[model samples]
Target: MNAPQTIIGQSPALSAALDHLSALATIDRPVLVIGERGTGKELGAERLHFLSSRWSEQFIKVNCGAITESLLESELFGHEAGAFTGATKRHIGRFERADGGSLFLDELGTMSLRLQEKLLRLIEYGEFERVGGSSTLKVDVRIIAATNADLRGMANNGQFRWDLLDRLTFDVVRLPPLRERPGDIEELAQHFAVRMSSDLGWSLFPGFTDEAMETLKGCRWPGNVRELKNAVERSLFRWGRDDAAVDEVVVDPFANFAGPFGGDSTAEDLADVSDSPERLSTGLPPRRDWPIDFQQCVTEYAKAILLEALEEASQQQKVAAELLGLSYDQLRGLMRKHDLRTRPPRRVSNPRK
Candidate 1:
């Protein structure tokens, strides 16, 4: 995160993005950040806020998809005491909390039909009412939302509100996934490793050895940067000796990565002249095309966890549990019921060429 608000890389696409971010900072309009999960939508929001005039105020965040439909309204618009079950205390929702500041609505596409209507009005009028209260309260908050889910696509699909979508985005910054920025993976890996080591204790990571780094870059990383971070953490745990150095980082992401694949990771898919004949040798099955094995329920759960992690490492079992304040072991056990796999991962290449 300390690597300057604008991300850095030698690639023309990445450099272009960095240049764009610098210019985009001067505008105060609502900024919508779009990308695959773990691509740092929130980081983009932080950069937007810090660059704006409202830097002096609060930057509140709310994940619309995290809350149940029943509670989402109250969480965003506040609610009078007794608004619903366990509503014993009067609550001020994210909007009011972010009054005079910026409110970051993550996963904004998950907002339900009813909630979307209320949100649209708030954006238009800068006012809203607590769920159980009739008195409309006004806020002077700036809106900055980020989502991996395609809100515009959802709106067109009728799952999201079109009017709300337009209101939420006047300026959108779409970030390419890590696969597009292979040039920056080293920097990102180091950043996440240092941060993870600090929180979990350096002892948690023995290293991301050169071999591990090769494996990591080869991974499809369906979960994106956050998944890469988790992979680094897991790699240390999987292979690290008790006395190993924390910075001796080695990663093999393809050893176990699994999620929906959208590119030509398979050699057959890319028979072009540039295709490399080498494979990552994850020891695991070809995840994207692998057959399902559900003979046991525990295996089922494992498969689900692996899939979830591959697609949304930022919200897979571990991250989801943390967001809900639950123990990871419990969730890990639950993951056993979903038919997850434990094969090795294969690395992928930058597809821009």
Candidate 2:
């Protein structure tokens, strides 16, 4: 058996789900885990198996929906050599391999009615016949199935076997979605960000700014924990500053984006500088009587363009340089000459602490 990692969350909804899972772990009967996508149904199954009496034995897993109907039967029940075309060697099935342990059947609602009948028999009688073999084989295996689909409703529609549903649903554990467990979002986001920072060879994770955390907390994560992790990692990568808190959270990377990298046309890019107040207007007076001081006007214009690019790039110096078509050294020199800084220098937080 593989060592199970901890699931990161302590919300009441999640705590109740874990408590229910622990209660059913010792029963040795089939269990059904129901949850939406990315809600950690597979993790729940792992917890169930590892905590059960069969923890020392094999814990096999198969996705019923991922395989075809014809192949699924042979996969669950071993096929004898020459059982069909290309069946050269005797193939042991998941049930046989999981004997005396647990078998996790994910996407159980997708199993065909015929295969469901065979599975029901195995659960009830603890015996099944391998494909192309006459003798019956028996195994003492516990079943732990999971699905996002509604199995009971499918059974009512004749898409699933009613008996199999009844056998599998001896106990059901439903995981709460991320939005329902709002208190866990910050911790989960920090955990993901810290791991991402480490992968990028950073000594510390700067963490999120107040505005960034508020943006994360206010959003409803439709894709749940997985979505939140992706958003956090993506935002940090785009921010590209390990020494500063992330001030932006890009929940949807594709929202309103155009061109190659969600950028406007090159001409439009230059318009920010062109439309500045310091730019010579079409209604300028005679050259000798012009009211604006040329040197001061030029200095203010450069500062305005620099600040605009910085704001557009979320204060990322490298990206702001790219936006202005300036080299990194050139941008640094400009900022130094203009007495400008993105934000006050702050100490980076030790992620380990």
Among these predictions, the greatest lDDT belongs to 2
lDDT of 1 by residue, 1-353 (tens): 13225453466655665556556767766778888887778877877777777777888888887999877888788889887888898998988888877889899888889888888898898888998899988899889888888776788889999887887777788877888888777777767666667666554544565644644555557778778778677655554454664432333334223332212123321222112223211223334544644233324333443454434333344443343233343333334424343334334432111
The segments of candidate 1 whose C-alpha lies over 4 angstroms from its true place after superposition are 1-11, 195-209, 241-353
Instruction: Give Cα-based local distance difference scores for all models.
Output: 0.64, 0.81
Candidate 2 lDDT, 17-91, residue by residue in tens: 999999999788999999998898888998998998989998898989899998999999989999999999999
The regions of model 2 sitting more than 4 angstroms off are 259-353
Worst 10 residues of 2 by lDDT: 344-353
Q: After best superposition, candidate 2 residue 219: deviation in angstroms?
A: 1.6
Evaluated against the true structure, the overall lDDT of model 2 is 0.81
